[model samples]
Target: MVVPLTVALGAGPAQAASCSATTGPYQKQVEQFLGRPVDGRQSSADCLAIQAFQRKHGITPTLGYAGPLTWQTMYTMYTQQWAGTTPNKAGKCPTNRGRIACVDLTRQLSWIQDGARLKYGPVPVRTGRNGAETRTGSKKIYWRNINHWSTLYNVSMPYAQFFDGGQAFHSVTKSMWNPPGSAGCVNMRPADAKAYWNLLRNGDDVHVYGRKPGT
Candidate 1:
C-alpha cells in the first residue's frame, strides 16, 4: 500500500549482511539516530541496535539488518510526521467531544483528529490478523493500563489502552512491521504508544475499520 508514511510512536528490511557497514553516510546516520557513536562498520552490536530501533519503530522484519527503507525512515525521523498535514491517502476520522482515534485498516494508517483538526497521527499501526482480526466500527476506551501483562499471551503489553473487550492500543518493542496479527489489539511503536497514552484517556472513542493484511 502507498501510505502517507506517518507513524504513531515516533518514529527495515530482510536478511543479514556479511558484516556491518563501516564507512558510509548510513553508518553515521544509524549511529546518530541511535544516540550513540558507531565505528562506521556494521558490527553485530550495530545490527542489534539498528534492529532494536527498527522494531520499536515498526520497521519490517526487524531483520538485524538495514536496507533502503530502514535508512530512509531513520533519515527523516522528525520531518516525516510533524508537518501537521493530513495524508492524501488518509481516511476520515470522527469528531468527538473528547479525543477520538481513527484506525484505518485498509490504509494501514491511523490518526487522531477532532473533526478535521489533526491532533496526532495518520501513523502506522498493525492490527489483528485474519481469525484474530481487530473489530471494526467505533467503541469507547473502557480502560487504561500502563503496564499490562497478557496472561493468555504471556507478553508485556506496555502503555495499553483498552477499547474493546481484551483488545487495546499498545506499544510493541518486539515486532511492529511483520505481523501474524495482534491477537485482536492495535499494536503501535513504543514512542507513539507513549504519545497516545498522553493524548487519549479513559472513555475516549476509537474507530477501527478495514482489514489487517498478512492474516
Candidate 2:
C-alpha cells in the first residue's frame, strides 16, 4: 500500500539481515495508536477507540495494522490532547516549561513529569544498526522538523554523547515492535512526534538509553 511505501521508501530498508521490513513498526503502530498493549490483544475500549479513530480519520478498516491515514490521524489526536495537558514531572525540566522528560529504551518508553512520577507512553521506535547502536546519554535537540513534510528528518541520524556519531530519537520505515528500530536515533512513531515536540524545545535534553547496565 502507499502507506507502507511511504515509511519504507522514505526511511530506507533495515540493515539487520534477520530483520524484516514490515514487522515491528506495523505491530507497534497498531498497538500504540489503537491505545492497546503490544500483545495483539485488544480491550473493548481499544476496539471502540480504533473504530471511532478509523471512522473519523477515513481509514479503510483493514484486517490488521494501520494505514498512513489512520497513522496521521492518530498523531493529530495525540498532539492535540497533549497540548492541553501539563507534563507531570519532578525536578525542574531542563527547558520548555520544565515539564517532561522523554526517555526511549530498546523495549519500553516512559515520560517523566516533575522528574519523578512516570507516565507510560510506550510507543514503538526504530533503532540503529547492531554496531551502530543507539546511545545512553543526555543531549539537546539541536533542531526540529514539526512539519516533517519532507525526508530531512527521516534520513538524518541523531548524534549522542555516549554513542558518539550515532543514535537519535528519529523516525523509521518498517513497522516497529515494542521498541521499533533505527540507525541510532530514537525511532518515534510519526503520530507521537507532535506530542513529543510539545514537551521540549530546541535546547531541551533528550536522553537515550538503548541498553542496560553501565550504559
Candidate 3:
C-alpha cells in the first residue's frame, strides 16, 4: 500500500502578504542560494524570493525567514541541480562497477549509473541521523519489497530496496526536507523510490559515500 503524498505550492495573495522582513540567521546563504545579492542582510526582495522557494518546497511558516532548515533545503537543491550530468565527476562511486546506484550522503543525493552513464537521479534523499548514520562504502541491493511494512518502526516503507542491514532505500509520506533525518534507511521521495524499484534489481551494486552534514 503505497500511499502517495502531494505537496501543494504557491500561497494565496493573503498568505503572500505575510512574508517576514526580519533578517534570519542564514539570510546571506539564502540570498546567495536564490541568486540574490550576497549582502548578508535581508531585504524585501530577499524575503519574497525566499518565501517563494519555501512554499515551492513545502517549508514551514512560509513567512520568508531564511532559517537553518530553509538554507539546508536550498543547499540540497543547489547541489542536486549542480550535479547535472556528472554526478560522479569525483569518481567516488566506481564507474567500473556497471549499473550501480550511488548515494552521496554529503549532498543528500542519489543516482543510478551504468559505467559513467547517468541512468536515474541526482534526486534529494533523507539519510540516517547522527547516531544511526547510513553506512558508507560498497554494498549491494540484496532484496526489494515493493510494499514493505516496517515492524520495528510501524511505518509503511513503500518501494523498499534493502542494501545494508535494516537500512534501505525507501519512500516516506513525509517531506524529505524535514529535520533530524531518517532512522537509517535512505528515504526518497515516493516517485524516486518507485523509479528506483523499476530500474534496479536484486544484486545490483550500491555504493554510498560522504558524511551527511551534522552526522
Candidate 4:
C-alpha cells in the first residue's frame, strides 16, 4: 500500500550529535536563513552560522552543522511546516523491522530509518522523469558498486546502491532539477550518495512511493 509519511518535525530530539549535515533542503535552507552563500557547498563559514543559530536555539555544540534535528527545526520554522505533522512511527518505510530507506518522490525527500530511529535523510532527491520514471515498490539492494558505470547511457553512476535492475541510488549534479533525469535511477548529490554508500548495504530494504510530479 502506498502511503505518505506523516512525521512531525519536532517529534524527536532533532539533532543527534553524530549525524552529518545534508545538502539541498537542509543546507540550502540553512544558507538562505543565515544569509550565507548558496553555492551548495558546506563551508566553515556556513558551519559558524549553523553553530550560532544552534546556540541561539539551544542546540548543543552549536556545531555549525545542520544535522537532522537542526535541519528539522530550521526547516519547520523556515517553511512554517514539515511534510506531515502527525508522528508516524512507521515513517512510511516498507519494513517496520530493520534499516529501511524510504523515498517519497512526490516531495523529493528521502530518509533512512532503523525501525523507529531515523538514521539519515529526509533530504532532497531527483528521481526518474516521465518515460523513465523510477519504479515504485519494495526491493532489496542486490548490490552496491561505488564506481558503477552504465553502458546504456555511458554515464557514471557513482556510489551505486542498486535495488530494481539498473535503478539505483547514485550521485547526480545539482542540475538534476533540469529535464531528463537518470534512466530510472534514484539520484543524489555526490556527498549524500557517498553518505548513503557508507550507511546502506546489500539486502537492505528500499521503499519507494509517490509520483515524481513533473515526470
Candidate 5:
C-alpha cells in the first residue's frame, strides 16, 4: 500500500468539489499522519491526501474528512508497519507453541508461525468489537467451512476456520478497516483469509491476545 506522492498536490476542481470542507476533530492528527502541512486546517491538499489514504485502506465515504475512524485506521497501519518482522517483540504470543496462529488485537494484526519461524503474515485484521470482543488466551482451530453462512448474522463468512466458539478466522466482504468490528470472529481480507485457510488446519493452535483500541 504505497501512498501516492501526488496527494500533496492540488486535487483539481473536480476532486475539490467532492472533498469535505469541514475540518474534522482529528484534522491535525490526520494532517500530520499524511505528511501534509500541519496547520490543523482542511485545505484541498489535505483533503486529497486524507481521502487517498481512506480509499486505499477501504475507509468509507472517502470524502476526505479527518474523522476519528480515519485516524484510528491510520494509527493501526502505522503500528503494524513499525512492528516489521518482530510482531511478537513483546513476547506476548508464545513461540514455544508449534504451528500457531497469533492474533494481536491491540495492533489489529494476525500471523502464522511454526516454532520460531514466520510462516504467513502480520496482516491487518478486524477483530470483535467493544461488547462482542474476541476472547483472549489459547484455543484451537476445530472446524473449517469453505463457504460458511452465519445463521446468527445471516451473512457469509468465506474460508471460515472456527477457533474459539462461534468466533473464527474468516473473510468478510466489507473492509477490514470498517468501524466497530466483527461479532467475535477475526475478520480478514479475502486473500489473507484464503491464505490462512490453506496454511492452517483443524486442531492448530490459535492464540489471541491484546485489547483492541476502542474496546
Candidate 6:
C-alpha cells in the first residue's frame, strides 16, 4: 500500500516563529510556494507577489504563508490538475556529456537535476502489482531516441530504457492508470512522461527507491 504524504511546505510552529519578521516569513513562503529556494530574507513585495502567484494556483490571498489552503492547491497541481499547470521548459535543462539520474519507484516518480538546482517533482506515475515490483538500484539513461514509442510495453510513448533489463519509464496505457496494473515497469500519464523525457538527458541520474510517504 502507498502512504499518502501530507505535502511538506515546512509551515509548522518553528517555521512560523522563524517567519515572525517581515523578511523571514516572506522569503520562506515564496520558496515554499514556487518550489524554488530563496537565498536570504526577502522584501514585502516579494511576499505579495508570491501571494498573487498563489492566487493564480486557486488559493485565496492571505498573509503570504504556505498555510493549509496554499499547500492544498499545490497538492492539486500534482494530482488531476497537473496537465494544465506543468511549465513547458523542455529547453530549460542544462545539457552536458554525462549526468546521473534517479527515480523513486515506490513513489512512482523520478527526480532530475542538470548538475544544479533541485527540481522536486512533476510526479505522475503508476506502479507494479504484488508479483512484479519496480527495482531499486543504480541505473543510467543508456539511450536517447526521442522518437521512440512504447510498443510491446503497451503504451504509445516516447520511450527510453536502462541496461536492456526491460525496466523503463514511459507513457501509460489505459489499463495501467490504476495501481497494481502495470507490467512491472513505471508507467506515467502521457503528458508527464513526455515532459520528463524532455527534461532528461543521456546519463542522467536515475535512483529508484521504495515506498515514499505517499505512493
Q: For residues 101-133, what per-residue lDDT tens digits would candidate 1 score against the true structure?
A: 888775566778776678887677777877988
Q: Scored by CA lDDT, what does every candidate get?
A: 0.70, 0.45, 0.85, 0.70, 0.87, 0.50
Q: Tens digits of per-residue lDDT for model 3 on 20-138?
A: 66788998888887899999876777777887877666778777888887987878778888888889899899999899999999888899999999999888899998899999989
lDDT tens digits, residue span 53-152, model 6: 5544434433445455455334433543443323223323333523434454433445454454444354556656566666666666666555566567
Candidate 5 residue 156 C-alpha distance from true site, Å: 1.4
Write candidate 5's Cα lDDT for 1-215 as tens digits: 21223233355744333677778899988988888888997877788888878877777777788888899898888999998988887888888979999999999999999987888988999999899999999999999999999999999999999988899999987877777788899999999999999999899999999999999
Candidate 6, run of 10 with poorest lDDT: 1-10
Please report the TM-score between candidate 4 and the true structure.
Answer: 0.59
Over 4 Å off, model 1: 1-84, 87-91, 96-98
Candidate 1: RMSD over Cα atoms? 10.2
lDDT of 4 by residue, 116-193 (tens): 777886666778878998899899899989899889888888999999988999997654343345568888878889
Clashes by residue pair, model 5: none
Poorest lDDT segment (10 consecutive residues) of candidate 2: 1-10
| Worst lDDT 10-window in candidate 4 | 1-10
RMSD of each: 10.2, 12.4, 7.2, 15.3, 5.5, 14.0
Task: Please state the error at residue 86 of candidate 3 in Å.
Answer: 0.7
* lDDT measured at residue 108 in model 3 versus the true structure, 0 to 100: 88
Per-candidate TM equals 0.60, 0.42, 0.79, 0.59, 0.83, 0.45
Best-performing candidate as measured by TM-score: 5
On a 0 to 100 scale, what is the lDDT of residue 90 in model 3?
91
lDDT agreement of model 1 with the native: 0.70
4 versus 5: better TM-score goes to: 5
Q: In terms of TM-score, how similar is model 2 to the real structure?
A: 0.42
The residue-by-residue lDDT of candidate 2 on 1-215, one tens digit each, is 21221122124466211211233234456677665776644334334445455544335543234445455445534643553334323322343434444554433353535444443354545455455466666666666654333254444322221213434444434444322134455555655644566655566556555452112
lDDT of 3 at 207: 97
